[model samples]
Each structure stands twice: as C-alpha cells, then as structure tokens.
Target: METDKKDKLIIALIIGIVIVLSHNFVSSQKSDDLVFENISSSLDDKKQTKLINNNDNKEKNEKATIKKIHISGEINKPGVYEINDDYRLEDLVNDAGGLTENADLNKINLALKLEDQMRIIIPNVNDKDNNENNMTSQLISPINQNDNKKVDINTADKSELMTLPNIGEKRADAIVEYRQKNKFNKIEDIKNVSGIGDKYFDAMKDMIVVN
Candidate 1:
C-alpha cells in the first residue's frame, strides 16, 4: 500500500511539472508574437514617413523651377505671370484669361517655350497692316519715323541694339554684354553701358523702353 502511494505521488508531481512547462511555453510564444507585431508596425510607419518626405521634396523641386514671364497686348489680363519653365506661350495666354476678340493669334507663336523674364506681345488684328509695313521698313532703316514701337533694351538682341542711333556693332555688343549682367531698370539705365553716356542715351531715349 505504501509503494502504491509513493508511485501516485510521483505521478502527480510529474503531471504538475508538465503543466507548468506548458504554461511557460505558451506565454513565451505570446510575447514573441507581440514583439513581432510591434516590429512590423514600426517598419510600416518608417516607410510611410519616407514616402511623405519624398512627395514633399518633389513638390519643392517643382516650385523651385518656376519661371516668371510677362504677357501684354490684346489680352484680357496683361501683366507679369509665374509659370513652369516647360509651359508654352499658349499656356501662359490661357492663364492670363485668354486673348481678346481682336487679338491677332496668327502673328504669335503659341508653341514657344516660356523662359524666365521673358516678355510676350499679343498683336491687335486691326493693326496688322501697319505692323507689316513697319516690319518691312525695319529691314531698310533700323528706326522708322512712322513706327511708334520702342526697342526693349532689357530684351533686345545684338542686331536690335544696333537699331538705336549711333550704336554700331561694337556698341551693340557692349550693350548686350552689359545687360547680360545688369538688366536695365529704366531707359536711363542704358547710360550705365561702358561707351553709352548722356549724349548717346539722349539720342535714343524716345526710341527705347525697359520692361
């Protein structure tokens, strides 16, 4: 009878040890699962943050590349505008509230790409004949008495600069070089050129403009 009791006691002790080990194993598994879930969640949050940052950076880069342009003449709104560098003349015109009913679209190149500090002039249909005559006369004489168009000193090329009175190739080249670094703020600013002075500027003051 004592032997039987001893065997029973031994069996009970063995069962109790097994139950404790099983409970410990299950708790360890649950802790491991929770740790895995937390690590996965942290990785997902990091990826989302990186994606958001990338989008913000892309937007900033696009804004940085924006170009400022000026549009005028025969338009609903004629003023300075900000646009993307890749935008064409048509896009700018559309943004400026489209052209007027009398706007001469045939004279403007809508496919021209926009540039920073660029100026665009939309012609009036009623002035077509006069504009053509002036263009023909410009080929013969740099300046025409009948033409009221003023040379834009800030945006004129070498040949256009030569149109000014007493401004030969050398002076034209100098004007172009000077304007490349220092844009003309006003008609009087042309006097800042190396060879241009009060006398030279006075001769072309009525014929030139800065925009």
Candidate 2:
C-alpha cells in the first residue's frame, strides 16, 4: 500500500511541474509578441515625423526664395539681377557696381522699392537734355502717306494693337501698361517694354508707329 501511495505522489509532482512550465512558456510568448508590436509602432511613428519635417522644410525654402529683377543701361555691370523681394532700388544700383561716373542720378529715385520684372535705365548726365529732345522727336512720326499702314501704338487701343501680327491680347495690354508708366518716345522704344522682344518687334515693325 505504501509503494502505491509513493507512485501516485511522484506522478502528481511531475504533472504539477509540467503545468507550471506550460503557463510560464505561454506568458513569455505573449511578452515577446507585445515587444515586437511596440517596436513596429515606434518605427512607423519615426517615419511619419520625418515626412512632416521634410514638408515643413520645403515650405520654408519656398517662402525664403529671392526675386528676379532686370537691371540695364549705364551701370558698370548691367544685366539681370536676382535680389530679395523687399530690397530697395538703391540696393540694386549698388549691386550693379554703383553707377558710371556720367550717370544722371537726378532722373531716378533710388529710394523706390524694388519689384520683380522691373527694368531700370540710367541716363547720361551731359546729354540728358539732348536725349530728351531725341525722344520727343521719335514720338512725333508723320504717318506714312500710304493708306495709314503704320499703327500709332502710343494712341492705339488694345483692340487696335491686337490687329498687328504676333501681338496678342497680353502683349497689347503690356503695351498699355508700359505706355502708362513711360511715354513711348519712339516706335522702337516698344522693345524695352518687357514682353516685346527683337522677334516680336521685327514681326510687327513695319505695321506700327509711335505717334
């Protein structure tokens, strides 16, 4: 009877040990699975943060960009200059190596605020009066005797300008804006009015006049 009792006790101890080990194994597996999930979530969070930071950087870069302004005529270095949008005309003049000794500072206000796509022309001090006379003369072109072939752009409406070849509504409106700020002294002076270039002027040269 004692031998049977001892066998039962031994079997009971073995079964208890197996049960404890199985419970511990299941708990350990659950802990490892939870750790793997937490690590994956952390990686995803880092990637999202990186993407947000990149977008913020790009936005800052776009806002902080400089503007383009064209500077020509009578400066030591006359060319297209890229400058800060808030910069003044004085700053742009200095950038172009100040001005030539003969430049007529009286003609322009250096304190004028700068804008994109602006063109500045520095006049000569000595010949300024003579140059003024020449400009007036160009504006007074006597119409060609032939059936009024030349279009007087200075007095022409937008519709009249659009009648010329290569001069669409945009170019025609640009002419009006330019003429508002600057009197077209000569028919050729239209070339200096931003969008009108050599090709466009050449295309409409024979068909246009200044008066």
Which segments of candidate 2 are over 4 A away from where they belong?
1-65, 129-211
TM-score of each: 0.55, 0.48
The lDDT per prediction is: 0.74, 0.70
- The whole-model C-alpha lDDT of candidate 1 against the native structure comes to 0.74
Query: Residue by residue across 1-211, what tens digits does model 1's lDDT show?
Result: 9999999999999999999999999999999999999999999999999999999999999888877776666779978889975898889889999999998765667777766765455656664222342322221122345779889998988888877665666677888889889998989988888766664465578899999
On residues 97-120, what C-alpha lDDT tens digit does candidate 2 reach at each position?
A: 988888766666677777665555
TM-score of 1: 0.55
Worst 10 residues of 2 by lDDT: 135-144
Worst 10 residues of 1 by lDDT: 133-142
Candidate closest to the true structure, highest lDDT: 1
* Clash count for each candidate, listed in order shown: 0, 0
Look at candidate 1 and tell me the lDDT of residue 191. Answer: 86
